[model samples]
Target chain A: MTDDEVIHMEHVWTRFGENLVHRDISLSLGRGQILGVVGASGCGKTVLMREMIGLQTPTQGQVWLLGESLAEADARRKQQLRNRCGVLFQGGALFSALSVFDNIAFPLRELKTLDEELIARLVCMKLAMVGLGETDALLMPAELSGGMVKRAALARALIMEPEVLFLDEPTSGLDPVLGEEFVGLLGQLHRELGFTVVMVTHDLDTLSDLCTCVAVLAGQQLVSYGTLDDAIACAHPFARDFFHGKRAQRILGRSD
Target chain B: MLASQSSAETSALPPLSPPEFAVEDGTAVVHGHWNLRGLIAASPDLRERLCRAARRPDLEWDLRGVNVLDSAGAFVLWQAWGERLPERISLRHEQQSAFRRWQTGGIPAVRDGRRPPVPIRRRIIAAIAGLGSHLLAVLALLGQLILDLAHLARHPADIPWREISATIHETGGRALGITALVGFLIGVVVSYLSSLQLKTFGAQVYIVNILGMSIIRELGPLLAAILVAGRSGSSMTARIGVMRVTQELDALAAMGISQSLRLILPKVVALVVALPLLVVWTDVVALAGGAVSAHLELEIGYHQFFQKLPAAVPVANFAIGLGKAAVFGLFVALIACHYGLRIEPNTESLGNETTNSVVVSITLVILIDAVFAILFRGVGIR
Candidate 1:
């Protein structure tokens, strides 16, 4: 874990009773990079994401995010850390009772630094940033299609313009067309926003088109971490099977 | 890297961020972090920068030597470009996507206008429409249940005995502790108050009459029904609501399983059988509390109290109370299942339906009890 790195996990072990989700896992992410975390089911991908964002404390290791130790921080210090990051859960997890506008504006309102006018403008800007029109803001999460919900969640995630963004399965449940578009949107946001992203996903097209690096969690550890090609070439069985399998070949054959 | 930078006396070093412009005469030099913090720092200068850049004749822009550029920074530059990209900007290969996003970003030009705030009349109409659909669903469910019951009536051995037993264990067995505790408390309070009044008239023994009639004829069934409604009724709603939310109900329909017979009927039948017994148990527990109070306040022995209880309230009131318990139990389960089936695929609706089920069940129990009282006014009152 280097000082300038945006997120660093040093021997993180997330354990619940006898089950060790992550065992002595170490990884680091630099600023302005998008890292895709992929694994087979039950590989603790979400748990690792939760650890990076200070939501889950590592059972026996340190999690450093944006130059501060997340697990060791006080509440005020943690709030400062939290302010620099945004996380989108798998289900969009939008407050179902709130309108899309209010959901996007929630973090801004919580900061209490921006006026209502600026908040409204920024909310609209965020909605537009994720390809949502102005009129989509008034609708509830329940009214949105699955793809729209993901985009709306992405907008809310970006509303704060966080330094580090964590998206859990950003493209899952979307159609091929929408998935492609969403990945394109992500790549655009990564460039313009300059945020270090950690996304737990299973979509190969997303990794191919957008991820600057990939991390594979297997055997209860970060079996490999490097560029997508590096991961594909790595000899770890899980990594090899994940990135060089028949399905991967079909996907890679089609992408730029 | 920064820490390793040597302190220099003669610094002819390159500018950290001195973004040059093709049309230097008019095009503004964009510099520094384009991140959230950078935009926040530069927000105070937005108007001055935008106005000055807009008034300039030339609009050609360049981004070389810029330390960092983010969406927030790109947005500021776009604003300076009059909210549209110029013919060209000197963007590095890596910055191409960022620039494209800025050029295309903002509220879409064409949009369906937001609907006006729903008027009160329209909201009311919508609510009524929702209610109409819900009522229709409930009616359909009732029909399915009746059909299932008819089928079972034809095949007496086809009763879902396992599920009925489990429901009884859950709704009836698990709930006995709380019911007994609450019933005993209510009994003690009533006996204490009535005993005080009766003692004032030197008619202390009459406390048995007051406690017996009220406990058996009214309080016992109501108390048990309310307890069951809060305890079991809420669980039933939550269980079915989850089944709906998770599409388990749909899966059952797809599998050709009779949900009414397999799911709804067992709950109703279990409650119908268990609730009357619970009411009797509550009556016994509550009368025990009253007898204790009677012993304390009036020096009446337990035997005397038990012997007088039958004469004081009569067996007919007990039978009437059990009948009410059955009806209350059936209605509570129906109401709970109705709300459960209505749950949407959201946590908010689960909570809302659970609350509605409990409230509606308890309210219906009281309403039905009131109707029973009026309808059978002279039947149970000796």
Candidate 2:
């Protein structure tokens, strides 16, 4: 894989006992592209994302993230690679024991080099970037509302200035207004930082607004992987139904 | 500058250069990768350099050669420049946005230094207040349980049989192996020790009396109570604590289900029914162990030992042991549920409450055993 390809999967096959999730899937995500993975329920969108991040290994084939083979990297090398990327889990997944300020500072503190003052300043900047104020920093994750949780988690993700970010259902639980605001924030950050994003999302609004490219997963294979119009024009029945549905039509139609 | 090149060129980029500054011709020339990684690698010396440069008011700043300045790098530069942009700094067009962010989003206030240690007088007063609140809460929980029992009495159909059965299996049925092992070992140890003492006094036969009274009346009930308190009490509290964390308890309340009846009552009933039986089971195994030990040590046959046990230790002692076991079970379950219900919706609180439940229940068990000993002092002994 070339250096510009931030993530590359080669002939990956995932199986659980007798069940097959992914079969001979190959894809490459270039740097600075927001690629959204979409599929019907139980079609392994999450499992595919997991494989990309090296959380789960495929039964066959190799996955390379940031030009290093995930299967070949040792523990320390894996940790270094992990430090270069950030993941926002479906649930906010903030450490419950830590307050918002500490959660954002966690990655910085792990470096063991940044002074507390610099770490604090960076955390505040990130919180403000994500539209949270300084006063909200002391609140624990459990006390945060759903929208604030997402914003706080986003702040934590971006604290390290990661080269790439992986998001699982970034706007799943938010109301329409908040979801839109989150998408706007994400887009603004993307423009400013130019980091690659690989997100698994079911929301049509999120896919259309944030994703530069979409990969449609179906029938244990990548049926279509391209721009929105390309995905819609594919001959696969799942892709047709996905992009031509009434809701998809309304959203994509308005965007066009 | 090599760090900013696009990755399309297959040549690997040079390793990040640690941020540095050199005063040349009365201007501070800053260059290299000024991002988090480079800044961290050279943090101490770099910060010292920045601070020394900041002190030189006459020096014009040159930052046009700096590569990849992130928010962290910007914040460091901002702090060194007295929380504002330097008037004489040269910057690249793209580098201006990082500073623009700082201008729009004003500097955050630094946290004050460490808090003062609390005074002893205030600490004592706070402790007393905390104790008072805990006592009140425990009493309120007991009152609610009483009311729940009264309600269940009025409408027997509302009883949660499945929950009770589940608790029974979890707390009692699954605990058989460990309790049996411990009981038998303790029995052998106690019997052997007593036989040693009796042999010294030419009173080997009295081993039966000592083992019967102590195992049946005291050790059996206390052992079972302590074991169950550590095992089941913590688990009960953790289960309810997690339910509270996930808002499952609130969901049940919204569905019009009484938490006391459905959750607390089943545990209380299960422990009350289960503990006495466990005590009895422990007592029998202990006696068998004692019989074997006596046979080996004192040459007392198993038949003689069993035959003499009932005659030596009266029936009232057995009754008192069972009664204590029942009371210990009730208190253990109640205390566990009380702490469980008190947990806040956070993992820290869940962990703290579960630990507190186990500790407090075990302490309560010992305290209640003392009270039982005092109240039933004259009845259970000869």
Candidate 2 local lDDT, A60-141, one digit each (tens): 9888888777777778877878888889998989998898888889999999887788888888888888988867888888
Give one digit per residue, the lDDT tens place, for model 1 in B1-382: 2222212201222223322233366555555666455555455656455657665655655666567665555655666667767665567676566556656555544222245788999999999998898779778877888999999999978899999999999988988999999999999999999998888899988888999999999999999999999999999999999998788999999999878888999999999999999999999999999989989988888998988887888788999999999999899999999999888877788899999999989999999999999988999676
**Taking the tens digit of each residue's C-alpha lDDT, what string does model 2 give over B1-382?**
2222223322343368888888998899888888888787775777777887898787899989897888778878887888788778898887888888988866455352123479999999999997898889888878988999899899999989999999999999998888899999999999999999999999999999999999999999999999999999999999998898788999999999998889998999999999999999999999889999999999999889999988999999999999999999999999999999889877799899899899999999899989988998899577
TM-score of chain A of each: 0.96, 0.97
TM-score of chain B of each: 0.84, 0.91
Per TM-score, the best of the predicted structures is 2
TM-score of 1: 0.86
* Candidate 1 error regions (>4 Å): A1-3, A254-256, B1-115, B126-135, B155-158
lDDT (Cα, 0-100) at B266 in candidate 1: 99
Question: Which residue pairs in candidate 1 have backbone atoms (N, alpha carbon, C) closer than 3 angstroms, thus clashing?
Answer: A192-B71
Identify the CAPRI category of the predicted complex in candidate 1.
acceptable
* C-alpha local distance difference test of each model: 0.82, 0.88
